[model samples]
Target chain A: MINEKDTRLSKAFITVSFIALFLGATAGLLQTLVRGGVIELPAGIGYYQLLTAHGVLLALIFTTYFIMGFLYAGISKTLGTLYEVPLKTGWLGFWMMTFGTGLATVFILLNKATVLYTFYAPLQASPWFYIALVHVIVGSWMCAFSMWRQYYIWKQITKKKLSPLFSFMAVMTMAMWFIATLGVAAAVIFQFIPWSFGWVEKIDILISRTLFWYFGHPLVYFWLLPAYMCWYVVIPKIIGGKIFSDALARLSFVLFLLFSIPVGFHHQLLEPGISHSWKFFQVVLTFMVIIPSLMTAFSMFAVFETTGRRKGAKGLLGWLKVLPWSDVRFFAPMVGMLIFIPAGAGGIINASHQLNQVVHNTLWVTGHFHLTVASSVTLTFFGISYWLIPYLSGRTLTKKMHKLGIIQTVMWAVGMFLMSGAMHLVGLFGAPRRTAYTTYSDHPQAAEWIPYQAVMAVGGTILFLAILLVLYIAYYLAFRAPKGETEFPIGEVEAAAVQTPIILENWKLWVGISAMLILIAYTLPFWHMIEHAPPGSQGYKFW
Target chain B: MPQLETNKPKKLKKAEKEQDLKGTLLSVMLLGLFIILSWGAVYALYLSR
Candidate 1:
């Protein structure tokens, strides 16, 4: 059982996360309805306002708070009373993040900051928006520091022993996030904030964009690694299998730390200010980052096969049938992995310089990210919530609720398939994303995208219903269920011939390499942008 | 308590484990192949456009 203090901390973070999820999802439904031409947007609330709110609340608030809460619970459970993470510091971080979210939400609601989540300057937001975002980042950094401190103390106490896999994964996730936020931090602090305050007359759009993408790509990993943590540490145990290899799991996280941050240039491939050589260099790094994901796929399948064989299943692919598919905890994350197979493949297409030309700035990009962040990451979080809410609230997840969970995931998969699939098809036919209304009715050339948009609207309605089901389940688990403690399922590794290498656990060495890589990838590009700086443009508000 | 014919079953289990490992490796290879083919198809479509 978790101590009272730790439980309270986790609960606070998770509660706020759910609040963010509800608000963000509401905005999502409104945007979809308006875009589909099914309903007109209410006056005084622009489409960009809804868009900004959806991105901030879901991408920034929901994911960050949920991750913070999950890591805290994971660390507490794995380390036990042996390590004391300062509860006071954690509470401080929570308040800061909450206050910051409130500040940002005000601006979004007022339509004072309709600069989308990318917030590319020349299209400026209120100064308060940038300041509010900095608070969110700084708040997250404090929480990360607290977790890192606990790890440090544990390491000091147990000199040579490798940290528990869950704790290790949690630390790696936070460390990657802390590093990834540096680019955004620089952009906000140096350029955007100053210009927004009228302290600077104009801002360099290219430089700001370059900085944002630097954070943008790794930001996806920041969302992904926690889901991966659950996949690596929890899913195997739920499925009645042991981890395939402990060493491989650690190696994968290490690989992510080394490769995830420096490859953001792939997002800027079409931009003119950044040169081809630097972009090519980042493209190579981008492909290299795919190795860890491939490693995860192999390890997961191996675990399934071994476990299925142990249960007396025979023949190739027969293992698939023997594994547990009914348990919501197991079913949700496994389905997430299945969706990611296609999503990851789509990501490869997005990263490829030649192929990206066909899909850039189109609904295809929207479709790709929806498959990733919306389907894969969001579904995994939904899965985590099934157990986590019950565990935190000391409640039993009843049988009825388990059935609800199953319906939620399956319906979500079907809905997302329809919506994202239609999006990809229509995108290829030249439908633009982020547009409130397409003049497809007037223009014959754009008419091909209309039917697909209708399909997307229908799919989105189904998805919105699925979200409601999830919220109901979460509410039932948290407030209505019978009180009981749930176990943290940390999978044990099956016996292997080889031992985990000591080098994989060397945090200092790995951090050094990650820093060196970022420096190599970013230094020259930033220098070029600064030295040969283009004429800056004044901020404008079209809305 | 008598230890009655445990060795034979132990040997069989080990053999099965080995077979499963090989199968797992094969499955990984197949998945990689599938991803590559999917990418190729998508890129080809893009080229046609």
Candidate 2:
């Protein structure tokens, strides 16, 4: 069991995450209804406002808080209790993040920051909105610094070159996060805040966007790495097996850290001003990410097969049947992994330089992320919650709670299939994303999209019901479940696994490589964007 | 020749039994196929458009 003080910290972060999930999901339900033309938003409420709330609250707030909490729990258990300074820093970070979230929520509700989650320049929000973002980013940095401090202290005490697998991965995630946030941090502090406050006459649109995507692409990885940690570490334990290979897991994470950062140009392929050659260069870097993803898939299958064969399973596919299918702990993430097959394929389509035009700025982009983050990442988080919440709350995961979790996962999967599937299909038909319901004055092309939008609403409604189920389960696990000890599952390395190389733990080497790659990818294009930049545009308040 | 044949087959069988990854291999290959097909379909759309 993790120490009591550490559990308190984890619980605080987890509680906030669930609260954000509830509010964000409610916003989502409304957006779907409005988009489907099933219901008009009331006179006071705007569609973009709800969309911003949905994106910021869930994509930013919920995912970050849950990840922080999960990482803290794992770090405490694996690395021994966090030291005094780091723990104090952790608390400070939590409060600041919470306060920031509250401020951001208020501004969104007041319609002062309906600029959407991207908060792209020229569509300015009130200065307080940008200030709120600063708090969130800085607060996350503090959390990152605190975890690094803990890892540093552990190395001193143990004198071990290779850190524990969980802690190492946690540090890598934070390091990537810390480096990635520098871009956004620079944009918000230097550009958005002054521009929004009228301290500056105008904002450079290309520079701000360039900076945002520098952080934006890695932000996807930030949400994802924790889910990968769960797969690489916790799932094996739940299934009564060892980690297939510790060295393999570490190598894959290092690959993500190195490759995921330098590839933001893929997001800006359709945008002008950047040269095609640079875009092609980054597109190639983006494809390099497939290496680690395939490695993960291979490792996961090998673990399952090896474990199943050891349990007396025979034949080529006999291993599949031996897995703990009925167990929610396995079942939920299993569904998530299954969803990634299509989700990842969609990502490949999105990143392909020429192919991006087919779905750029379309509902298809939105649908693709819904699968990757919402279905794959969020479902895995739910799976972790089934045990982690109970473990932190000093309660048992009852059979009833387990069954409810299974139902919730099924609902989420089906909901995403209906919604995201339609989004992908319709997007290929040239339906635009990020727009409110419109028929372009009942044009035939727009008329063709109506059925798909209705399907999205139906899916969104089912997803909302699943969200309710998640909240209920969380409440039960935290406050109402039978009081007992729930295991915090951390898998042991397989006995036959080879030794992990100490060089993998050499932070200087990895961070140096990561920095060099980012510079190579961005420096020239960024220079050109600044050298021949257009006159800055003043802020707009179209909403 | 008879002795060599018997030993080689036994060695191969033992190794396969000890650590079989054929299932994993097949699974990933199928995954690769799915990705290729999806990417191709979209690329075709891009061309037609």
Candidate 3:
């Protein structure tokens, strides 16, 4: 009965997202022994392969595809357009992505692309990984185009200023994504793969890692933005209040697009050859990134607080009881907020200059992102699924299944924290990230943490089961609902609210300004390749 | 006090919306630039030292 094209696009993205998460979670389970010292690698399985797979699974594929879908929904609602490009092209993009994903995975299994997910240079991978990756980039680019075209088409039709909520975030993430991928794709197509295939003479390692993660860190946000978008717009609208401020939401999205990509240098804090000014500038930016995230926390809480007060909850912490925890829509945001605490707090410290030395490349890095991502991004996706499934299929989730899903989410959140806390403690003591096992016979430092890593593995198992429960609930909602007429209105405000129109800025100036930032940030390091020749170092060319 | 009475709170004003947009864009972009420069600075400093 649901004829809306955009809603269907959102659902399609959700389904694909679930698929991607499954692969990611499955990887986590396989590598629960990742930190185990005694477990040796198979002759074919390399350490970098595992690292790349985990990074790509959690960071790139799941997040981008998920956000792409969320953008579809946000555009339709904000602009009130029922455009069909997203629908027709969305599935085409999906098949391409899936094909690309399969090829990438096969490359991993075949022991082909082991440069780590970002595919840093000197380390090499099979050509197919690069080939399939191009497929993915192209498909994603098409999807980005789909989003861009829809918004432009809507602008022509509505002429009303669109709220920033989902549309702004999606557009910015996609743009950054396009920017970040260029560096990696250039490395892959021109340098690494070609070198491996004997076409290229050599490849630049530093330049590749630099650009890959520029997109890499924010890539997680691309996934997270959709979830955040849903959280910002939907949670408020559903929880019996208007979004505290849609403009703030839009600003955050645009801010994320502009600021998030440049901050990738934070990942290279421990690396050599980058300048002090660059790191100093990035550390400052790292702190600044927290502001938007913190703003989101406050605005979301404001919306939740508004809902809580309406329920007549009084006093500090009184609103805790007021939330309809059983309602999937309500269940996720509240619980999801609870999980964001450790992750967000930990991220702030991890981003700091002094603290980077303390926990760099340690178990805490693993713990921090696991919570930030699994909690914020995953739960948001789950909440959207709850909203999307019943709306699209016209069937309500059984109360029992719904309740179970909530229980499972809580378990995953709480369990991940406990598991990760132990890892953080060990990480502070120098347990490195992305290693085969801490218990190498040669290293004495790792012995103390073997038991701790084992415990963390136990946590992964628990989370795996919990994630399965979530997937099942989603599946049931999508496929198992009883036949009936069910309609949950999207874009409905409890009461009428005034709609605002967009004010066009000097587009050329803004674009030029953004371009200037990129050129200024990147030019020196790029120029350094030739200008400040490190004596006795050989010049490597990608092309 | 000419307040429009409704169950929902008053809608966000256009100017207010613009302010938040500007602030958010300013804050987020500045932060991103900061983070990107972090590694490059550290590397450069480590060398200088």
Candidate 4:
């Protein structure tokens, strides 16, 4: 169990993450309404401003802070105490991220930075915006370093025994994130910061975009791996099952670390200047990353089947029926997996080079990501919050709250289905994304999108209600619920007869292989970009 | 007594293990089928366009 001080620190991170979710989700609701023609834009907040706030708060602030908090909890639990961690440095990281978030929030609110979440330059924000983001990333690095330090000390103490799976995974998550963020860190510090401050006359769009996506694509994995950690470690325990194969689980995470970063060019399939061969190579790598996910899907399903059958379930699909649907802990993440099926399918289309052209800038892309980050990732986070908040607060999750959680998850799914579903359909009809309103007075095609926009609005409304319910539930659990200790569900593997190989735990070899893969994927393309220098663009602020 | 007790439970455990393995293979097949069909449908949609 974590000490009180560590729990407090963890709570601080989680609390801020929820706060960001609330604010960012509010902005999303407004955008949905605006797009749906249900409401006009509120004064002083432009569409891009809202978009920037929504994306940054949810993607950057909410996910990062939540991951940090969850990892702290996982580390403390698995390592036997929080004292092994450098608590002072952990607190420092927390404050840095918090302060940086505050700084960026100010600029965003002031409309000083309306560059969308991508923050793609030559559309520059205030230099402080870039600087603020750097602070956030560096703070995250501090947290990652703290995990590394803790693991190092743990190994020193327990020389022969491998670290627990949860601790191993927590460290891996931060390590992968640390490596991935270096690309963006370099881009920000070297290029965007200087350009924003007027130290540079022009900035290279292609290089900046390339660098951003280099970080950007893997950033999804950063959000995902923690969720995967929860699914692998926590969900099986909740459902009364063991992990199918610990070796397979570790291998899957290792594969993710290797293949996740090198495939960013797939995001730029439509962009000019990058060689077609390089894009094709990256696309292949993107497909390779799917292997680990498929492994996860298989492992999870097998676990569920084993558990259900042991409980006396018969027939092929009988196992599904026996799994705990009433238990919100299992249900929420399970539903998340269900959504991920379609989300993963959509991802394949997005990665397919020729097919990608059809949906490149369309609302189809928006729909696809909504299913991914918005549904699969966010729902899992919500599921995690159900147990985690109460665990940190020293409170028991009530049955009533669990019921409410299930309802919230269902509402979110329904809303996403209606909204994202409509978005996908409309995208097929050629509706563009990133626009406040698609129904142009002059364009005949715009009229066709209005109905879908309305569906999106309705879906957004339902989702907003669901968000409100979640916030209320979280608040009630943290502050009002009766105090009690909660268990951190860490499942065992059923096939205990088969021990995970000692070689699988060799982080040094895996990291080396990951680096080699990244080098192979990136070196030539990066070299080409540098050698064939194009004239950089001057900063432009359309918003 | 020890030999008889251990042997009976061992037999039961083997049977249970077989059942679990069968269920796993069945689940995998279904999941694979779903994945292939979904991918095929999406690709076919794109090709049709």
lDDT of 1 by residue, A1-543 (tens): 888789889989999999999999899888887777788887788888999999999988999999988889988888764245456678778988888899999999988999888888899889999999999998988898888888888788778468889999988988899898988999999999999999999999988888898899989999999999998889889988888888999999999999999998899999887899999999999999999999998888988888888898888878889988889998888888888888998899889876888778888888888888888888888889999999989998888988999999999999899889998888877788887867756898676677788788888888889999999999999999989877778898887524788888888899999999999999999899989998999999988
lDDT tens per residue, model 4, A187-264: 999999988888999998889998899899989999999889988999889998888888889889888988999999
Candidate 1's DockQ is 0.57
Compared with the true structure, model 4 gives a TM-score of: 0.96
Model 3 CAPRI rating: incorrect
Question: Which residue ranges in model 2 land beyond 4 Å of their true spot?
Answer: B1-14, B17-19
Clashing pairs in 1: A394-A484
Assess each prediction's global lDDT (C-alpha) against the native.
Answer: 0.87, 0.94, 0.67, 0.88
lDDT of residue A254 for candidate 3: 57
**Which lDDT tens digits does candidate 2 get at residues A249-289?**
99999999999999999999999999999999999999999
What TM-score does model 4 score on chain A? 0.98
Name the lDDT value of residue A367 in candidate 2: 97
Candidate 3 lDDT by residue in tens digits, A163-248: 34456556666766776666666766766566767675566667667767666677767656766767776776666666776556
For residues B1-49, write the lDDT of model 4, one tens digit per residue.
7776687977776776766766667766776777778667667877888
- Best by the lDDT measure: 2
What TM-scores does chain A show, candidate by candidate in order?
Answer: 0.98, 0.99, 0.89, 0.98
Question: How good is the docking of model 1, by CAPRI class?
Answer: medium
Which CAPRI category fits model 4?
Answer: acceptable
